[model samples]
Target chain A: MATFIGMPAFPEASARAVGDAQLRHNLRKATHTIRARRAAVVAEQPDWAGLRAAGAAIKDRTLRHLDVYLERLESAVTAAGGHVHWAEDAAEADRIVVDLVRATGETEVVKVKSMATQEIDLNAALAAAGIRAYETDLAELIVQLGDDLPSHILVPAIHRNRAEIREIFSGRMASWGRPAPEGLTDDPRALAEAARLHLRERFLRAKVGISGANFAVAETGTLVVLESEGNGRMCVTLPETLISVVGIEKIVPTWRDLEVFLQLLPRSSTGERMNPYTSMWTGATEGQEFHLVLVDNGRTSVLADRVGRQALRCIRCSACLNVCPVYERAGGHAYGSVYPGPIGAILTPQLRGLTGPLEESLPYASTLCGACYDVCPVAINIPEVLLDLRAKVVAGDHRAERLAMGAARRVLDHPKWLALAQRSVGRLRRWTPRHLPGPLSAWSDTREVPVPPRESFRDWWARRAGEEGGR
Target chain B: MSSRDRILARVRAALADVPRTETPEDVEVPRAYDRSRSGPDVVELLIDRLVDYRAVVREVTDVVAAVADALARRGAHRVAAPAGVPAAWLGGVQAVRDDPALSAADLDALDGVVTGCAVAVAETGTIVLDCAEDQGRRALTLIPDYHLCVVRRDRIVRTVPEALTRLDPSRPQTWISGPSATSDIELDRVEGVHGPRTLEVLITPAL
Candidate 1:
């Protein structure tokens, strides 16, 4: 599987991101715009809190009886003329997809914007096996053409402006399929037209389509995809064979449950009461073959965690990303995973396990300000999970920090020792240096070291008490 | 064990701490959302919402004139309609009747598609097509650059829940809010993507 191998730890990548003036500008502009819009639409729903609670409850019920639901879903899909496959991990899922595409004797497949495919690096896997996957979503197309990693969940090319998109479309479209028309301007509509013409041919001719579902209804065996561009509609409908890789946690118990998500997702993600399009198909359509791959790629492990399991309720709305101050400054690439922002901080470590420096740094990537919790449509308590992961991290490694914390705990445990230490520090205030050496310097790297006061509060209190006694 | 059995086993083990006897019905889901309100209020709200998405909405007594005017305004010369659509609905505009065997390229060659919708949501201004006889296939509304859908005001529901109850889950459904749009470019909504560039919905009086 293609992984975020050899990626730098969060701090290093974030430091570089903070220095990129253009990236910071783009992140601020895009995030702020979506944030305000989300707030407005959310305020319109008088029972938003009730809806969120219900959404969370529905997911919890599905997950608690996941095994039973999976069986029911498999049978439901089978009855609907769709084949269901189970994948233990990314490798298995990729193998299933490649084999399915190979069976059709097709070398190229068009894809909708799917986080699952990105997680498994399915396109790269297909490429290794001599198959090409074309991303048809407008933002995804920009990312694929630019040979860049997706920086945002909803809008992958959020970091790029209109001018950059035009350049990418102009320079890259020819190599893929249709070339951009000459004199293509940076206007968004013009760029969209160029893409529509370019991908329309691919959509019309492609034999296979690959996608990820926003919600998969177990009762009806229906897969639902919510998108703006008709690209998703084209990919799913116009193809001869369709393969969907869905996370196990995406299942909702009944078709009626779509009411909660259909309400929460658009408002929280795109700030629209309803997105431009939502396509729901039970299984195989009349002319198309269908395959459903239920992927457990680290999701089963995510489910095993008690406190951490709530992360499974995430609908991938990216509301947390829009409200994250850390994400705004550090940018998405700094997270080193397809999943980024507040959700990524807790989710990545749990899914991939905290074995690497990148995963380890992810837990500490948040200020725990709880803004992510406020905007989450599912109401996933991101800060609670972040702190839980942090405790796990602290329990495992960071011997130096642990030792330092232990020493501070000793002083804090004894009031007399703390007062004595404070008095000595007060006496040395005049001679204290502004900068420190060693690991403590990491703290002062971007901040000034505070100066110690001339007198201890304890001494001042004692002196005042003696004066009162004398009087 | 097979991957399927292994995954199920894993899921079972993961939830070992929770009682296995608990059923999905035991969980309480609050449906406090407003699913009430109907009549003229719902139809007006649908129009207001559709206008917000830049969809050209019109209230008309004569569907034929409305459809004809929509095609004329867009200078659409070649239009398509499903065979089941009432001929009187497309009285003035000449429409190429859709057949099941119509290739995607054939549909793409047309200027626009006009049809009736299965249902319309008043709160969200969404028109859902269930591939019914009049609505034709999913590609009919998608491949064309222009889409003119005639929605009966009686089909307009107050909320998403109300609309869901009116439709069936077994059939393939396409929910359209406006013309194809994308917020991909700096989160700024640019309408007209791969779907129809222009969406004109003619609202007929409640039956």
Candidate 2:
């Protein structure tokens, strides 16, 4: 739960990340592959622009009346024999989930890959409560087995190659459950097979399943999950009790609205025409029990800002991450949050509040090339929000900066003082250091200092006038 | 105050800029996207899309013979079929009826599963199962390593929007685009995962 709490600021983290040649290579190769595939598949849809527009508008409409839609969703889910709970923050959400699992009398639960649950740090909470949660997705399994933090939103273990995956499976699969096959190779097929064998037993015996929804239809009270592997199906269907921790923003007002997102998400996320499996269930099915926990967890605070709130429209497609130039070199781990990339740059600071060095530094993480805006399905103006957050940060503390700007304003207000300062800087040109001293070095570390000119423009203009008069 | 009440209040306060007279409908959503198809052959498109996902597709005049042939081709000995599935579809194989609702372990031991789809989308090559009698429970299609689905030509639609209209949201639904696959490894797709690794589709004329 505290994994990202005290991480260093973006500059330090990204500096370290860029130096790791393997990470940069992995990110470049993966992002480029997915980027080309997404472009090709997206091109196949002639109505893609229309779809993108409608997708953005629909999300806007939903957010504008989120209260109304959430009430309707709660009623619909209740009518369908599902229980609904509201959590104000991550701690409350974790407590609710842990209590639910404890009530089920099961010490272990199977899980589908869900960003909401990760944001809440549900796995760590479960472990603290003496309960175990197993991650069923191929990438999640790799991360869980390796005891690693997820780097990418879609591909959690995207940083790890096939060989590293084989090592994790062979070295660590035993204590969890079934061990990897003897002499397992680095082939993806073999690694996937090893995971299949490793987690199959847990899936069959799991009595409780935990998940997050891709979309929640308020009209029919149905929850939809789109995934490539059948592990999502196994987790949601095979378990007797299912708990879904969903962000308040995941709601779409009607079932028909799915047509827009269903077409948009798969192509944008994994570059597939449609993911292999999409499960939609309205509340409890036959012998199963369903619980829907609506988590605020700073989402309401995010919604309070009209300029920053557009970020809530994100469907977690990771398209922005794949297209971001800064993300390709620096990678996901550098962002220091479960959410990463261009979207993360704006989202993390807002959600966590620009309190510490990490949160404050996140807004400046992007180069603002606007690749994220173009690929965004919901059309979240990420750069606009980043600029907005930057203004908010500067307006806040930073006493020295404010004081320096005030002094500069004072000098500029008086023409005589401005001329005197320019003359002094010109005279001191030789003594100017390439890098600034003290705390100011942080700013100059990545930038070059421009040496002062030998003469002021005012002095040069006056001397030229005098020479012309003499002639 | 209750968490729900507080959260709702926060949402209302956040939208103070939005005029009270403006309703949710005030927001405009452009719907010019294609919801239906033109003259292209839908079946051909479905087949092409399915093949693109590495699914094994066969066009047959006789569904029963095709199903039997598909199972035989995989050398599948024990196949699980839902109650609503026609007995003839499993005539050539050792059919395991889901009357008792096979346990997860039992389903895992089976060679494969055969079922009928609610609808198939031509554009996305997706076949949806609503857990109708023929499709049984969701796990029936999962757990097993191989799946042979019977998608009737008449049940195919041209686009995702059209398919959505035909589906009942109340029913628990599973939309299968192809065999279970993953792109998690360096973003390279490798088919066959937790779901049926091999998905074989038999397209036949209306029953």
Candidate 3:
């Protein structure tokens, strides 16, 4: 249940990630494979671009009028025999879930892998309250057992290779519930079998199931979870009491709107035309008690910013992460949030605010490559948002940077000042070192310092024009 | 103000720059994605997609023998089927009729479950169960190690929207494309994680 507070800045963390050969190898292999598959399936659709446009439009429409749709969803969920609770922040959301679980007098709960729950650190919250929440998704189970944070959105343990997973399962399975079979191997199927045996007992006996929604239909009051494993089915169906904590932005206007997202999300994230299973339930079932927690948790502030609110439209597809070059090199850990990569580059800053060094550095974690925007099912224009956040960072704090930029702006805005500065640099070109020292060493460490080009382009142009005129 | 009202106020305040008169419909969504391209060939596409997902698909003239044979092949002797399903469907197999009173352990002990689906989507090879009479409770299909689903050919739809129209929004729905699977470990797809490890689909003929 920890937050990404006090994390080291992006440069420091990414420096280490860039050095880890194994991490880089795993990331490159996984992202490139998924990226190629996504490109192939997305190409199969004749109207993928249209669908992407519509997905963005629908999300924009919903976000602008979220108050109305959320109200509609709450009423609809209530009419369907469910309770709706509103939380302004993470602590309140966690409290509401803990109390709901406590009311059922249940000490254990099964969880579907949910980014919202992860964002709020719900499992850790539950653990502190003397309740153990078992993660049933194979990736999440690996993350939980290994006592690690989820690095990827869809495959949380994307950083772990099969051999490492075998070790994790073999070493950690018994303490949880069932033990891994003798001599468990690194084969994917065998590992999956070991997890299945371990989590089956917990899923069957658990009275409470906790989850997050991919989309919450305001019209039908249905929450949809698209997943690859049957863990979602087991948790959502078998539990007597189900509690789902979803972000306020997850609401869509109607069931028909799902057609647009269903087409866009699967092809973008898992690179499948459709995932293995999609579970949709309108509020509670006949026998199960249902509770829907709508969490604001800085969402209201996010919605307030007209330019930055587009991050809210994300379906948690992780396509942006797969296509991002920086994400490939730096891996998911550098962004220092539950969300990492291109979306996180813009999102974590806005959600947490650029108040800390780590949060501020996140905005610069991108090269503004626009690859994320190209593949985004919702067309978030991540580069647009990144540049916008960078402007905010520049406008705020950083006295040295502000002064330096001001001096540069003065020279660039005036022709004479710029010429004088360029000539001075040209005259000193012979004295210039190939590398710089002190704080500027970071810039010149891996790059050759330019020799001021002998003369500024402006002087060369003027001289050539004069010579031509004389001739 | 309470968190609800405060949150709503914040939302309104956040959108201060947005004109107050704008409605959700003001943002026009281009619905030009090909929803009309589906046809009868979608059925074959459905079978191909299901096969790609590695589900055992049997186009059988005799439903009973096909289901029984598939169950036998999976070594599932004590199978479970919804009471509403025709008794003849599992004619020669040892069938445990679905009971709401059965616990998870009770259902887990069974070798597999056989049930009819409400509808199947051709485009995605998805079989949707809406907790219908024949479909039984969700646990019937989920808890067991193997699931032998009977999808009638006529009940197959060309697209997801068509399947959504056939379903009752009130009933809980599980849209299963294949057996339970995961791409969690280094993005390699592995079947049989949580739900039925093996999904055997019996497509009854159009007649």
Q: What is the TM-score of chain A in candidate 2?
A: 0.93
- In CAPRI terms, model 3 is classed as high
RMSD (CA, angstroms), candidate 1: 1.8
Model 3 interface DockQ: 0.81
Answer with 1 or 3, whichever has the higher lDDT: 1
Q: For model 3, what is the C-alpha lDDT against the true structure?
A: 0.88
- Per-model chain B TM-scores are 0.95, 0.97, 0.94
Residues B61-114, candidate 1: write the lDDT tens digits: 988788888889999888889877899878888789986557889989999998
Count clashing residue pairs per candidate: 0, 0, 2
Better of 1 and 2 by TM-score: 1
For candidate 3 chain A, which ten residues in a row score worst on lDDT? A437-446
User: Model 1: per-residue lDDT, tens digit, A232-276?
Assistant: 999899999999999999999898999889999999999999999
> All candidates' TM-scores?
0.97, 0.95, 0.97
Where does candidate 3 stray beyond 4 Å? A1-3, A433-449, B38-40
Q: How many clashes in candidate 1?
A: 0
Tens digits of per-residue lDDT, candidate 2, B1-207, equal 999998899889888888888888899989979998684798999999999999999899987788888888899999999999989777788989999889989999999999999999999999999989888988998988999999999999999999999999999999999999888898878898888999999899986
